[model samples]
Target chain A: MPIIVNLDVMMARRKMSLTELSERVGITMANLSILKTGKAKAVRLETLEAICRVLNCQPGDILEFVEE
Target chain B: MNIKSKLAGIIINVSSFVIITGYGYTLYPSGIHNWMYSYKETDSLNLPVSQYEALNDSILTMRNLKNGYGFDHDNGQFAYLGTQTSIACDTCSYTWFKNNTQTYNQNYIKLNAWGIKKELPYKFYVKNKQGYVRKAVPVKNSDSKFNIVDVPVKFRYNTMDDAILIPVSADGASLFDTGWLILWGLNMIGLLFLLYLFIRFSYDTSKGRLFTRKNVTRLKLIAVSVTVYPLSIILLNLLVRFVFRQYFSPEVVLKDMVWYNAYIVLLIGIVLSLLYGAYNRAQLLQEEQDLTV
Candidate 1:
């Protein structure tokens, strides 16, 4: 619960829509939506690598931690 | 899928559907009707043999004729026990005959047989109109007044070898009161509930809701209900055993092949409960999988 996913912020910075990102990242939009909406239980290392490569951002930029 | 596999799947599905429908149809009302109406009016009676003296005289005359014909009337003990377990079926047996008003509370009759004289040869006889019948029951060899001669049973219930609990009215007038409803009515209701649970299970399965919390709960309930079904049968027998002991007071012996039947259903229920546990774990895993991106 402390780990917050900030995938939508990175997508907005890259000016990419969820459908275009999902198609480019070779994953379903539903799964990408799950990650974007912070509903994903775990982010696979390969998936994070693909999303980082497509969005041209570090994993730290997409994922943030909050003490609450 | 391949054509062969598809065809086989269709065949299996069609056959299963037909079989289930056919089975349900056959079990609707008549199957239960037989169980409810198995006992007839003559099944229970106070005077098992009305004209004991007349029957004895007739047997003696026949024996005399047999002696003249150089045939021996073998005096043997017929150890045939009467099938009617409930001797208190009619109001006369308990209330009027016993002259007890309070006996109506424990109306069912449980009959127990003891002191079987094996030495007495069983005599088979063919009367003029009565056709074939047991010739004569041997009189009291000892001081005990009752002897079980024959038992003709048409019951799906347990082989209740105890006292009979008849349903009687308050004033000891009517034989059949609401006790039959307690037996047959409750059986019908239980059966309907089981059918409903099965339908719900099938509906949930068809809807692809197999590994859900509600399904697991339903499965648990189904298992418990199945287990309770057999247990209710045992409880009914035990209830009869308990109620039979209230008045006139006889030793109780509850032994029947059907009594052992509960163990089989109990084993099935245990298996279902284990399935319920497995399904719950599977549901948790499914939820986790769904949550993962």
Candidate 2:
């Protein structure tokens, strides 16, 4: 519940739409929306790797942890 | 995961279906027939009247005295005025006796008694030692004595045994019988429904929907049904006992194996409910994973 996803920030920095990122990373747009909204409970290493490969960003750039 | 689960699910589904169908085919008929005919006694061994008199005396001697419809009998001394309504020593305290007469409105009792008098007359039978009705007594009770009704003789000496006394017509169709059939029929329906739920759950698992909300709900339903199934049976037993206490003695339903089996079912339901909770947690995790992208 504490971890947050920063996918939308990275997508904005890359000048890419969620649809475009989903196409590049081989994930669904709905799933990308979930990541962008910070509602994802967890992220698998492989999926993070794929996302990083597509957007040219580190996993830390797309993920953040906030203490409650 | 999907293929292996599918194979396991298909095997389980087919096995369950076959077992249920096999039980329906091979065992249900005779079992149902035996239960249905529990009220009817056959192959009675005839005993002499003197022996019956002695047997009756011994039974009376062994038991204590209690009030019989408001008549008090002295200890060690008693009388048999007629069937169970007679003022005899209390041998029947082994079970609860419902005073059907006083519980009624006097006017209704009178009306019902009158209607019964006009309709099929009570036939008295002399019971043989083997517990068969040897002869029907021709003399009927005078109309003035409406309370003196003939009690049906019990086939066995043990008065505490449970008997399902369904008041059927000559053709054996009555309200009580119909209701009993319907109640047990619902048990069968519940079993079939449970089977369907099981198959559906297995199918969902095979389709990789094990942690889905739909599968969780299905498991909950199956759990509730399993719990309720035994409870329904216990209730039906109680209902039968309460209704037929006058004509026959019903065993203590809680003393039977059904009660023990019910506890097992309750355990199963609790376990299944927990399983559903676990699946719910898994579903949340799955959602998180799907969204992780």
Candidate 3:
């Protein structure tokens, strides 16, 4: 619960559409939307790696540790 | 599913249906069941007059002490048909006296007087081992045999108040004559409920709804029915024993209670509960997988 997803902020900074990122990362828009909306319970390392590679960002840029 | 789980489910379902159907067939008739439960002693009622008189004189006596209607030793120790009695001992008190009796509104007390009272006009059946008929008898000929066990019996007597009529050394008042009927009714209700729940579960499974919320609820319901049905019946049996102790012996009720018949349900309940847990976890995993990237 303390781990918060910041995928929307990174995507915004990259000025990329979810549809483009999904196509580049070989993941569905639904899964990308779930990650963006912070609804995903987990992210596979391969999926994270693909998203980082496609978005040109680190995993830390899309995921953040929140104390609360 | 492996062959074992599939086989287990099939066995439980089929066995339950078969047993429920078997109960329907076996318990619908009174004579057939009585014949099934019939003791080896077919000639128990062939006692001579002198021996019966001697037994009446020596042993303690229980009369037809009911005010309105009562069992002819079929329902309890006291009955309506004059003062009909079936068994002398306490152990077999629920034993059918197996004869006819007539109603009387007089207060009569004589241990050996049922011989004349048995010849009154009207007739009603009293069940048990052969005992004296103190009520009025209209047709004493061979035609009377047809009327036996055909009449519905009713019971009326306080469990505690009847204690005075029973001797301390006597075995006790008992009622096992119609216990099978109660057991049969309960089993039918339980089995029907089980069938209903199972049908829905099967429908969900057929639609590939396994590990869904609906399936989880179905599994839980089935498990609860399987577990609660037998337990409630046993509790009712125990309740009968406790509540009927004033008139009918608890031991006799316990002996005929349908506790053992539904034990298989409990075992199946355990299996379903385990399945429910697995299904619940599987459902959670499925949800997580769907939401996770």
Point to the candidate with the largest TM-score: 1
Q: Against the true two-chain complex, what DockQ does each candidate achieve?
A: 0.49, 0.48, 0.77
Interface RMSD of 3: 0.6
Better of 2 and 3 by DockQ: 3
Worst 10 residues of 1 chain A by lDDT: A35-44
Docking class of 3: medium
TM-score of the second chain of model 2 compared to its true counterpart? 0.42
* Candidate 2 ranges with C-alpha deviation above 4 Å: A1-14, A19-30, A37-39, A43-68, B1-173, B245-255
Model 3 gets an lDDT of 0.48
Off by over 4 Å in 1: B1-187, B203-209, B236-240, B248-250
As a TM-score, model 3 comes out at 0.50
Give TM-scores for every candidate, taking all chains together and pairing residue i with residue i. Answer: 0.52, 0.45, 0.50
Candidate 2 per-residue lDDT over residues B1-293, each given as its tens digit? 59855554454333333432343234223322111111111113143555444333322322211211212211110110001212222233211222223221000000000011111121212222112111222445664433222333432221221211122232233333344456557757877888998999999999878887788888888877776766765675555445545534221123434556778988888888788788889988886666555
Candidate rank order under TM-score: 1, 3, 2
> Candidates' lDDT values, in order?
0.49, 0.47, 0.48
DockQ of 3: 0.77
Residue-level error in angstroms, candidate 1, position B96:
22
